[model samples]
Every structure is written in structure tokens, then in C-alpha cells.
Target: MHENVRTLLDTLELEKLEENLFRGTSPDNGWQRVFGGQVVAQALVAAQNTVAQDRHVHSLHGYFIRPGDPTIPIVYEVARLRDGGSFTTRVVTGIQHGEAIFTLSASFQRPEKGLEHQATMPKVPGPDDIIGQEELTTRILESAPDAVRHYWMRPRPIEFRPVSFEHYLTGDKLPPAQNVWVRCLSDIGDDPKLNAAVLAYLSDMTLLDTSLFAHGMSIFDRRVQAASLDHAMWFHRPFRVSEWLLYTQDSPSSSGGRGLTRGSLFSADGTLVASVAQEGLIRLRQKSQPDV
Candidate 1:
């Protein structure tokens, strides 16, 4: 396992507080708190720890409280909500500083035959044809707004390859639609569930940025303030996230200082493995003028 993946697995091994209660430590990072997806994915893992192996999580809904404290350990309290013949449900509350930092309700279902249909993946260049997000970030920071560049051009977990090299760092503020091909940086084994969870973690990283595109604002711009509020995801098919997955995202509406974004994750061969939706706080911050 990669070091980061190992850190994640260790964090999910919640310390037993009491029967059905546990506490999880935050990874040692400099973020204001735990990354939103980390808590969501970990909570789901914790919930799954108590269930049968045959059951796989198919859906999840989560809300972020105060940003999590990476310096502090999170306490997770699991509720055995329902256990039936073919379906199981669990609710996990992540607590830090005696307050609920995050909470998730996840549902798992055993494999079953069902009707199947999925929207075809959009036509896009293959991964090898596009530049990675890190490389693009470095290239764009040369002329980008300093504030935006300094904040967004930092290191990250996974590498992203947009189908076409356009609008990423150009400060062009293009349309609200974005199709990026992404995959893990390290060989993260062949486990489908782990891949799904990793995808879930990455999905929360940038969906909101799509909502800001049409407004002529970049996430790097000082006048823009964006953060995810609620996130929900649906698993559509079984696939490995270690390989290429197309994340097509769009913003349907933005108003009242908020925006809603939706996206679907598809395998390189056009299998829609997951769908995601999220709403975020899109309030603009006070502008800081650039040096003349």
C-alpha cells in the first residue's frame, strides 16, 4: 500500500471506546481539519467494519459540521440502524472536541440482478494525451493571480488529466462543464471497494470548482470563497478506480450565494460506476487588488 493509503487505513481503525462506539485519529496534516472526503470515506469504512463482507455500500449521504481538526482524534459512534436479509444500513457520527464534526448514513446491499442502463461517457482524449493537474498548475501559476496560484498550486494526493488542455490555469473562466480523466498515482491494489472509496474521496475535492467556472471566478481568485456543504454519491457499477475514470461534472444552478453541482464517474470503457452531487457555499470574499 502507498504511504497515504496506509495512513488512511490506519486512521479508519477506530479505537474501541465501548461496545458499538469508537474513536478515530486524524492523519497528521496541515489542513485546517480533516479533509471532508477523508471523514466521509472513513466513516463509511467504519460502518462497514461491522457488517458482512457480502454487503457492499451502494449509497451514502453526509454533512460537514465545523472543519475537522487533523490534530485531534475523531470519535465515531455507530448505530446499527437496520439489518435485513439482503440490505443493511449504518449511521456513523464523527466527533471531535466533543462536537459532531461530521456524520454519514450509508446503505449496503448484496449483489442482485437488476435492470441496467448508463449514460455513455463523453468523447475525450485518452489519459496519455493530456497534461497532469500538477504540471498544469505549475505552468499556469506563471501568469495566474498570485493569491490563486499560491493556494491552488500546492501538492495534492492524486493526479488529474483533463481530456483537453484548456481553461484549467488560463484564468479564462470557461463554461460550467468539465470533463477530466483521473486515476490513482500509486498502485492501490485491485480491490474494487477501496477504489470506490478513493474515488469518493477525490470526488469531493473539485466538484464545487465547476460551479464557479461560469461566474468568471477561479478557485485561486481571492474574491471567491467556496466549500462543500453536503455530498451524496451513488455507486452504479463495480470497477477499479486505480485505472482511468472519467469525471464529468456540471453546475445546473447557482443562486442565493450557493451552487449545486453534479457529476458522474465512468470507467475508461464508458461504464458509469458512480454518480455524485453536492451543494457548496459560494459566497465571494473581499477582493485583494493585485500589484501594479
Candidate 2:
């Protein structure tokens, strides 16, 4: 495991607090608020703790109610909403400072035969052809703000190879759609549930940026502020995080200071694995360019 990934897992400390409650700690990854993706992943882990190993999480929907303090530990209270012979459902609330910072509803289902079909994966450059996020960050660290260098620009445990990273920043801005491949930095052993949860963690990294692209904005330029308000994910097939998977994202709508983006995940062999949707806050800060 990467040093950072180990630190992150250690910070989470997924321990049982009560019969159905799990306590998750926060790592001060230099963010004032707990990361939305971490909260989602931890909640999924907590939900998994209460279910049988044969069941797999098929879907999860969540809302970020309040900013979670990264200094405090989050108490995840899992509610057994329903349990059937073949399906199990759970609702988990991440609480800090006596308030609900995040809440999630997830459903797990036992494997069963079903009609199967999925969109074919788009042709894109393979992961080996692209540089990892850390390498990219290191090259740009000299120009970044100290805060960004220390936190936002840190090494990403997941590797992402955009279809064309150079085009987004240099060429004519394309449409909101983007295609990229992602995978874990290290082998994540044989736990499908953890792999699914890791997918939940990786899902939120760049989708909201697609909305920014729709307006010809880049977070790198600092012309706007963005934050996720809610996230929803659906697991379509079992897949390993250790291998490369394509993530295709696009934004369809933005209005009243909010933008909605959706993404689909596909295995290298063209099997659709998951779908994700998120609505995030995007506030434009008009920039003053030098007078011509």
C-alpha cells in the first residue's frame, strides 16, 4: 500500500461502536471539512459490516447535510431499514458535533440471474500510456498555492489516465463529456465489498469538474468554487479495483448556481460496472483580466 493510503485507512479506524453503529475517524488531509467521497466510502464500509459477505451493495444515495469537521470522529449510525431473503437495505448517518453531516441509503442483493446488457467501453489510450496524478502534481507544484500543494495536489491513491489530459487545458474546450481510466495503486486483495466501496471513493474525484468545463472554467484557474452537495452511485457488476476501469463523465444541466454531472464506469473488457451522479455547488467569481 502507498504510505498515504495506509494513513488514510488507519485514520478511518472502522470499528464497531454499538450493535449496529460504527465509528470512523477523520484524517486531517488539510481539508476543513471531511471529504464527501471518504464519508460515502466509510458509510458503505459500515453498512457492509452489518451484512453477510455473500450480499453485494448494488446502490447507494447520499446527502451532505453539514460540513463535517475533519478534526472530529464521525459516528456512523446504521439503520437496518429492511432485510429480505435476497435483499438487504441499510441507512447510515455520519454524525459529528451532534449533527448529521452525511446520510446514506444503500441496498445489497444476493447474486441472482438477470438480463444482462451494457454500453461498450469507448476506445481510449491505455493506463500505461498516461502519467499518474502524483507525477503530474509534482511538475506543477511550484506554481500552486501552498495549501494546494500540501493537500489538493497530494498523491492520489487511484491512478487516472484521461483520454487526453493536455487538451482540456490547452486546446479548444470540448463538450462536457470526458473519458478516463482509473485503478488502485496497490492490490486490494479479495474483498468485493471493499472494492465496491473503493469505487465509491474514486467516483467523486472529477465529475463535478465536467460541469465547470461546460462553462469553460477550470478549477486550476480559480475562476469558480466547487463542492459536492450530494452523490448517488449504482453498482452494476462485480469488479476488482486493482485493474484499470474506464470512467466516462458528462454534465447535462446547470442552473441557479448548481450543476448536475453523471458518470459511468466500465471494465477493460467493456463490462459496465457502476454509474454515478452528483450535484455540486458552482459559484462563479468574475475574474478581472488585464486591460487590453
Best candidate, lDDT: 2
lDDT of 2: 0.81
Query: Model 1, 1-292: lDDT tens per residue?
Result: 5666566656656677787777777776677757888888778777877778888889999998778888877888889999999999999898887898788999999989999878988888878777766676766656766765655555555667766545545666678888888776677777656776777788886688888888877565567777788899999788876788899999999997788999999988889999999998888765653221
Per-residue lDDT tens digits of candidate 2, residues 85-193? 9999999999988888899999999999899888777887777777667666766545555644554455667777777654345424667788888888788776888
Compute the lDDT of residue 194 as modeled in candidate 1. 73
lDDT of 2 at 119: 79
Off by over 4 Å in 1: 133-138, 147-153, 164-173, 286-292
Clashing pairs in 1: 33-68, 148-220
TM-score (C-alpha) between model 2 and the true structure: 0.89
Q: lDDT of model 2 at residue 169?
A: 54
Model 1 Cα shift for residue 102 (angstroms) = 1.3
- Which stretches of model 2 miss by more than 4 angstroms? 133-153, 167-173, 285-292
